[model samples]
Target: MKTIASCVQEIIISSPFLEEGLSREIINFSALAKDLNKPISNMLRKPVKNGAIMMALRRYQQPLNLENSNRLKTTFKALGDITVRSNLSDFTFQNSKTLIRSHSQILEKISANSQIFYAFTRGILESNIIISSSEKESITNAFKNETLIGSKDKLSAISIYLPNGNSEIAGLYYQIFKRLAWENITLYEVVSTTNEFTIVVEDDLVDKAFSVIKRLKD
Candidate 1:
């Protein structure tokens, strides 16, 4: 008979988290065994151990670090006070520091959602502009070509918004993303504008990823 521990191990290795590599930093079987007060060796011996292993693999697949720790606090501070109900947008393919312009409608829609994560000073707009729903549709449709570079298993995307007179700021943002990549946090998508940059990640990693960017502003 297959030992229960062994079975559990088999299941974990089979899961997508291990296969996809989106969050390898957060998941570790041996660490989990220690946490649960079980010996790593014994946990490896159970039948259907594969399932447990996979569960453990996914448990921390979302990157959680000092950045997210602060983001949660800041997000709460900036947008948390609003009464609108909004789900955190799944910007799994967005990068930061690029100017983002929305069509009339998207801005309105975004304004309604309370989970809005960032604060930008719109210097020129006489009034505080919000993302109306129509504007959201126009912007998403406006950007036709999406460019992503890196390995398929680990990819990063950066949105480019090269406008007159803003090259220096763009370079700074690029450098920041590059440094994070050096730390092995692969980026998925980058959305940009002459003055804005939006970074995206797997949904599970959003909070932790947000934390990472928050540090740069501090």
Candidate 2:
């Protein structure tokens, strides 16, 4: 059965900013309890006192924050190389039966050039391709018949080398994305592997983006 504390915890986890604010002790507990009163009551199928919600929040935030903070600290300290590749292009295509075939063509064309940067991600509705600007023509030719949803030139990508076992770290991605969003940076495209995190942004803003991520290590 749902209780006040469980409901409050559910609310907190769903809203990441709330978790962060509460973690930092910057959020107003009484005010938060009042705001959450209706939701917790609805979840428990009954009325919940504001003071009871506040007490649950107080009970949960510290240990939760401490655990996450310790993991984050270790992860950042173990962060590997941060490589930035400039002058890239991003292409978004509406997915089609031919999409995978077209992507293969581009890969075959550029496979010989180890210096060229390329990354492709196929989503359910769309397929995104990011490549070195000089290599954009190859993709354009390869995907000529595909439906192009959007494309951006003069983009740059930051490929962050993550430490081992990052996939097991809770809230790891949230913290990285939170820092970038806090800086008001626009992420044009993002792709990742098990231990490699990549973010593509406009060419001009790359330096600022790099600075922001680099500081995460310090």
Taking all chains together, each candidate's TM-score versus the true structure is 0.28, 0.78
Tell me the whole-model lDDT of each prediction, alpha carbons only.
0.40, 0.87
At residue 68, candidate 2 shows an lDDT of 69
TM-score of 1: 0.28
> Which window of ten consecutive residues has the lowest lDDT sum in model 1?
79-88
Clashes of 2: 0
Q: Could you give candidate 2's per-residue lDDT for residues 119-187 as a string of tens digits?
A: 988888998888888977788898899999999999989989999989998978888898788677889
- Which runs in model 2 stand beyond 4 Å of their true positions? 62-72, 95-101, 108-115, 123-126, 168-171, 181-186, 203-208
Backbone clash tally (model 1) = 69
Clashes of each: 69, 0
